[model samples]
Target: MSRRPADRQRARVYAWEDRHVAPHGGDLLPFTAMQPMVNAIWAELGLRYPPAVEPLPRQARRLQADANRLRLRVPEQLPSWVLLHELAHALSSTHDGASDGHGPCFMGLYLQLLERYLRLPMAQLAPSLAEAGITWDPAAKPVFLDAAPAR
Candidate 1:
């Protein structure tokens, strides 16, 4: 089957991460600490978990991609919620076999998982996301998935 737009976009993000984000201090982030959380979310959502976590290069700016894994830029400073946001993307992509494009479904599921796993309310999560330059608006354009064409 042909790859979906979301899949391609996800790949692009991964590429960006690999080339620009991984080379810096990205490895110092709490990757191990985040694994269990990611797995838990994946199990709950019934998604295939990625085999491993790898660091993307560091020059990554607004856009980045990692190796079929999570793709995120390393901010000069990162907030705790940033981890959760990327985790949500990873889980959603794995479970659905397609990127949800950070849309309402993705955000709704993410918020639920965040509350359950992190014990943080949506209100609390929003500010942290905003602080990290992550968008809280579900209607915002997603980086990965897009609407499929009508047959």
Candidate 2:
């Protein structure tokens, strides 16, 4: 007898994303709290403009640079790391005009934001990225500004 499709197929599995604990040992930050933080960080980073945070129809988080918006799945818990990644996209888009999408410019911007603003250690971020099947070059240096303007 032939096996049914369901029987033949393996169970569906989703990719594992890195879960980060808040400084106080809490889970992800709610949208209300996170949005303001994004705005402040954007200003602190001296970006030309701040992106608005909006609800995304789907469960994935993404940055829409042209619109200057960050779309995130609503009513879903989002790790701080994930939000930081999206902000990196915003920074890359605004500051980097030379490198193409997700190229060296993007990586440098992301790493700089992660280290400078988020205070995330390379020790932690690198491994988390590797587990997600993304390879990051540790030698990539972040572009520094002459003087970061105060918000």
Candidate 3:
């Protein structure tokens, strides 16, 4: 799994996100605030079930997500952009995403999630993805991207 392109290149992914998407979706939230937000993203993306929002794995040292849970570091790193990245993981896990993990499909969903949730313009996102060497499909967006998140 770690040998996969996206997994191996995850540093580049973080770098890409840092340079391009930072300061865009960094809305900080507490644990109480994040559950509803996570559920909302699940519903918006049409995922069958949202993962449990839990505390960071102590060893994770970073945001983590899977089919069953979205583990986060509380107090310090609770940002929307971080949620978007992990949500993409949760979404991908539902679609048999284990094969590629953080590969194209996952990153594609992350980009679309960014587009939908953060309103980040693809005009800006597209070029940076290339520059960052993070491959993404423009058309890989879900239908929910066209609609606004629940209010």
Candidate 4:
């Protein structure tokens, strides 16, 4: 069966997370444990408010821009990168616009936040996205302030 792009991205992020998580001794990293980090990323992006993260009843991750929150399928066991991915969506809506989807603009925002705010290296994330066939704009600039929304 063919996999959705998001599923592919999730698998890649999860694998990378697994390799890095070994030092923590296999304990599950809960969303609460990662909230501060997510908040920091949100603030670093100069968002007016931190995105709200909550568990969705269904087994699928969703971004609710109008509500200014992320509806996660499994909040308790969310991987750090996945949280960052959702945060990118939140920031995109806040700065870009509520109508933006997963396009070049979104991809650029996602990469910038992941690298600058979440501290994931481009050397690591870029290859992963390439392998997953997710195209992004290398020249896409990240928002550094709330002065204006990005295009």
Best-to-worst order by TM-score is 3, 4, 2, 1
Model 3, span 1-151: residue lDDT tens: 3454437657888788888887787777666877788888778766545667776666664444333233333443477887777777665553323334566767888888888889998778888878878776555543223333676
Candidate 1 lDDT over residue span 70-96, tens digit each: 433333333345555566565445423
Best by lDDT, which number? 3
Instruction: Provide the overall lDDT of each model, using Cα atoms, as 2-decimal numbers.
Output: 0.48, 0.49, 0.66, 0.53
Better model by TM-score: candidate 1 vs candidate 2: 2
Extract clashing residue pairs from model 3: none
Clashing pairs in model 4, backbone N/Cα/C closer than 3 A: none
Per-residue lDDT, model 4, residue 82, is 58
TM-score of 4: 0.54
lDDT of 4 by residue, 45-118 (tens): 55545656565455444631122233333346654555555665565454323424455555667677666645
- Note the clash tally of each candidate: 16, 0, 0, 0
Best-fitting candidate, scored by TM-score: 3
**Which parts of model 1 have CA positions greater than 4 angstroms off?**
1-29, 43-51, 63-78, 94-97, 122-151
